[model samples]
Target chain A: MAKYYQPEFECMALEDMRALQSEKLVKQVKRVYENVKYYRDLMDAKGVTPDDIKSIDDIHKLPFLTKADLRDAYPYGLLGTDLKNCVRIQSTSGTTGRRVVAFYTQADVDMWEDCCARAVTAVGGTNEDVCQVAYGYGLFTGGPGLNGGSHKVGCLTLPMSSGNTERQIQFMRDLHATILCCTPSYAAYIGETLKEMGLTPDDIDLKAGIFGAEPWTEEMRRDIEKSLGIKAYDIYGLTETSGPGVSFECEEQTGMHINEDHFYAEIIDPETGEVLPEGSKGELVFTSLDKEGFPLLRYRTRDICVLSRKKCSCGRTLIKMSKPMGRSDDMLIIRGVNVFPSQIETVLIKEGYSPNYLIEVDRVKNNDTLDVSVELSPEQFSDTVKDLAIKEKALADAIKTMLGINPKVHLVAPKTITRSEGKAVRVIDKRKLHD
Target chain B: MSVKQISVFIENKKGELAAATRYLANHNINLRALSIADTQDFGILRIICDDPKATETVLREGGYISTVTDVLAAEIEDKPGSMAAILEVLAEAHVIVEYTYAFLAPDGHAYMIFRVDDNAVASAALAGAGIKTANQEDLF
Candidate 1:
């Protein structure tokens, strides 16, 4: 049986959690002030004492730690604790600048595994279920994170990393695996392969899928579920937040319950630094409470979403968050306006095509413009004369609904684009000003 | 003996394919038999073309991701029972097809290009069965 622990500290009435947060938060501030030079200097530079964070509500007064801050701190600068205690470190190859490495102690790993166990359990996974992990392993946090959690849940786990689709299917059928964890793109590929192989959903006993590590659409969810004959669930997290269990979809299927016990969530206006009220969309920020090796305070996760207090069908009393729309970094500034890749995605799916498209932002002269690229299905390829105008209108209407900005839609043939095995590249921003 | 087949990565979107097509069209290049393998994010546009060099030049100039590769094109009898015979030969020869697609040929035979399980063995097996397969010469 998989042992699970719901954070009692989080589910306690809102006031108690806040009280606990304030108390633990104070200790963290003092720990950083006394040991970590960067944070101490930051506080010194601001003329703020650790005692200034008097209440949990005073968190807004603290400076937000951006990815830039992480880069400036770099390597050992961010760690408040000693390197000796770190059991593991996971990171993304920081193509933007400095590689973002996060340290996890043994206790931190245990907690991460517990959270992942909750993710597996939330979707009705049990000891009897076979959890097949296909996310990339090693430096990438996805594979090992879920592997540990599946083991914690006592499920028969396959530590298969991504690729080798044929062998993947063979193992899937051979192990009689029930749960799948991988990127949404890989899931779709696996699903497509199963269909190509003439294997029915009944051919293998797949029950649930926990997909993440890349952004996907509801249409994609539908496609995956239909192909695999299973319920598809989204798991959310980044390497910085301990991989794919920062929040996860419950049986309710509305949104993810932000495990508010181990971590606290805040949504703030990216430009003004003003915290948004509940139900308002803003950049998500985090403050780790229980994390020991390298707990972060006000870590500005560029992911944008709205917080909700609405009670979930699932019994969990944790606060819910709308599925992360997209990252702030991925937000496009076209003609002096901001746009997100997900906005285009929503429109594309609603327009009834597989929401597979790319946004190319370029500066011709001093003005910025966007070129939206899409793939056309074989069904639509029958009539070049009639279908062209209809498909274009549908796509244009979708752009109007989602982006609040019009973009030129270019229709390409299906399979004309490169498929990313990891994170789907959504935008090719070539605006010289931004670069 | 060669026809050049180029694989271009494109998003499944409106105008994207046309842009690639128009670029090639402007260069007076023709797509002989093209197929796209699509997923949600992107698909690879595989093309056998009359002007592979010109097509690659145009595609690159148009800022598209493309690569040219060699693929075998086989002649299949365009009849109901022909496919069965083709598969039986491969089955006996212990050869596999990774992926395959068909195109109509002018002579009334179906030309199928296959990504084979074992390229050398499949080529030998098909030759042993006396099935006429198109090499690079037939492609151009």
Candidate 2:
């Protein structure tokens, strides 16, 4: 049977949910305009004000917030509530420039946890379950978000952060953890470790897994499910909004259902910022309807996906979002062709190689050169160099078919590509360094 | 009739060949005979080592993609056309040689390693021609 943590919000009627979102958005805009000078100035420059935002329909009248705006605001410029009211902060794992830091008030944290709780409940979590949160605990939001949500769901939450795979499995088996939460790569690693330790899915009591914080292919999802003997669910969120639990997959597993009551989602053409109609594939934009500490209006998520309002079998009236195709930031334009590492990954897994691989892009004499270094597993290794060359050419040809651009494929030694414990780093663009 | 040869895949980059050799040297593995086939991007380093199994294990532990294959190793004359005569015999037998390399033994005997399409046919043809071929034990 379908389950929900907050059935009232999860199964709310479309009209009622929109009414609630509009109410929250109006109050949120005014709160940001009055409290945040950065947003207030942006609103003035855009010729928008609190009075202009009468409802969610008027949200387009307000200016959109980008990562650049957050950078300009820095540490405290965008805080909507007083410092005394702010209780916690979570930071992004951004490697370039400045890391984004999001503040949260007590109420804001409660709301975020409630979103996560709904996600856990959707995956069949209950008070009888034990939840293991294996996402990194520190500044990364994955751990804390799921941890709080598991608590809210009354599951015996395992605060075990990421790493120490042996210990993770130890506790998982000893405590009979029913739900696991972490990035998709980590979940795969755990599954790999389980095999290395001669443990099978039957030995563990895990029933479900919540994997996110990075893009993963459907092939990876099936692989994880088979290895761990759990139905893997994808969760979507960003620190810009409130860690994870922005949206989560229900039993339907088609797409994640957005918590429409709290966050209003809009798909916009990334180039023009024009809002596209429902079911359109475009960049995702979110407005934290009632976040008190750092209320952002129309924050571009940079994730490309389509949203559907089709009636779901999960009995949730909330809209569903397809798994992000790729982040606009993660997309690489090489030789005038746009390529995502996830697309390359899908090809790799399909070709019977581990998802561990490296993509190197460089510019030579003004021409972009793409090199893909893939790890050769023992099963694929051959005695004849001619056979190996044929394998490499076949892989390169397959990738060229997928990307519409030829790439030099190098079959490296197995386990040479770095294993990701959190989000995998798959691309190294030498072109950027030269620029 | 045939001996085990370890072939390692190394990228066509500076020090990759040196790195593979250094790994073998570090593991105390000795190369009895070795040959390299190079292309634009990578090279296959084929070696008849003192210990084929140990060399493979060390190379794998060093994160090198390697595989072992059975290749006919026949003792040949040190003079010119020694390889051509062996090749002519194999050609007459219709045993296609994929790749071949030669090295001088410490005892002053020359040996040629021939990777053929069918090792058994090549070995029988070479034996029938009165040419002596080294087995895995004889190579060491």
Top-scoring candidate (lDDT): 2
CA shift of A156, model 1, Å:
1.3
* Stretch of 10 with least lDDT, candidate 2 chain A: A91-100
Mind giving the per-residue lDDT tens digits that candidate 1 earns over A1-435?
Answer: 422345363256777777887887888788877767887787788788888998778888777787778878877787878899888998764232445788898988998888888888888888899999998788777899899989988899999998898888999999999999987767888888887898878888889999876555677778889889999998888666787788888877888877777778999998887999999999999987777777778889888888997876666777888777756786554542346677677677767667778889875432356788887754444211233556776787668555545677777755555789998887897743311
Give the count of colliding residue pairs in each prediction.
24, 0
After superposition, the stretches of candidate 1 with alpha carbons farther than 4 Å from their true spots are A1-11, A331-435, B1-140
lDDT of 2 at A103: 96
Give the number of the best model, judged by TM-score: 2
**DockQ score for model 2, please?**
0.32
Measured over all alpha carbons after superposition, the RMSD of each candidate to the real structure, in angstroms, is 14.5, 15.7
**Candidate 2 residues B1-140, lDDT tens each?**
78999988877889989988988888888889999998777788999977888888888778788889999889998788878889999999999888888987776778999999998888899899889999777765
lDDT of 2 by residue, A1-435 (tens): 339888899999988887898898888888899999999998999888799888788988888998888988888989999999999999864322345789999999999999999999999999999999998897778999999999999999999998899999999999999999988778888998999999999999999999887666677789889999999999989888998899999999999999988889999999999999998989999999999888888999888899999999989999999988756677665543447687788889989988889999885533467999998887787767788899999999888877767999988876767888998889988764211
| C-alpha lDDT (0 to 100) for residue A274 of candidate 2 | 95
